[model samples]
Target: MPLSEFGDAWPGGVPVQAHGMDADPFFAGEGDLGFARQVVESAERGELFLYPGDQHYFADPTLPSYDPDAATLLLSRTPAFLGVVS
Candidate 1:
């Protein structure tokens, strides 16, 4: 759905949570953070990003895809984000 289509029924006071990474596919509504930052700046907003190491998952530490550093960073960073959106 178009973000702007929420109309008057939309919860305008609700905060948004954006989950992004350095390496990932761009959804139809997404673009580079540089582009995101430009849009945020134009709209007087802020942007958050996660560009940690090649860690793909956090729980299964033994997995070949697990990344220790990225997991740690995600641990430290995601809370503040949830706080912001909640």
Candidate 2:
């Protein structure tokens, strides 16, 4: 559902979103990214990570689009963002 639809029903807590710059059109396009940005901007706490030159499934090891660098960075940042590690 669109973020606007959530209205006051939006979930609480910090949101962490990671997306590739070249995300698949079927999954997400420029409009989706713009909407994501709006979500983060409207939220009290949120994080948006955009990996340039990467595509959808960039963090999936089994996928050909897997990007070791971006995936590694994502893995590391995720735990940190969740306060799971220092």
Candidate 3:
């Protein structure tokens, strides 16, 4: 769905967590950062945003693009996010 749909569906607000890397090849050619910024800007009251910066930071450990520290940080923070959203 489009980002506008998200804005329309949950007028109250929603917690959002976005993870991306500046050097990620997949996003390099696209406007991912711009889109993400829009989402963060449009976020409702109390919403959240999270982005880990590294080339393909969220990739699995088996992937060369994976960043251990970033992944660990994301893992540690995830539980808190779940709590907040819940």
Candidate 4:
């Protein structure tokens, strides 16, 4: 659903998390970063990570586009972002 439809129903102070690859063909990474920036501006809590020259499914080890270094960094950051104790 489009963010415009949320209106005031959107939860306030919710953390937004976004990860994107600069070379992703399925989606524009710059656009993703822009949206993340908007969310961070409004919510004041979020993280946006972009891997340069990576494609879609870069984090999936089974995929040919897998980027081990990027995926490892993503894995480490995800837990901290979510406040997970692991």
lDDT (10s digit) by residue, model 3, range 1-86: 34675554334456666666665665543766656666655666333334445475465798877778777876777787678653
TM-scores of the models, in the order given: 0.42, 0.74, 0.66, 0.75
Candidates 2 and 3 compared: the better one by lDDT is: 2
Full-model lDDT for every candidate = 0.48, 0.69, 0.61, 0.70
Which predicted model would earn the best lDDT?
4
Between candidates 2 and 4, the one scoring higher on lDDT is 4
Best TM-score goes to which candidate? 4
Question: Could you tell me the lDDT of residue 19 within candidate 4?
Answer: 81
Off by over 4 Å in 1: 1-10, 25-46, 52-62, 84-86
Residue lDDT tens for model 4, 18-45: 7878677554544655555555555657
Candidate 4, poorest ten consecutive residues by summed lDDT: 1-10
Worst 10 residues of 3 by lDDT: 45-54
Score candidate 2 by lDDT: 0.69
On lDDT, who's better, 1 or 2? Answer: 2
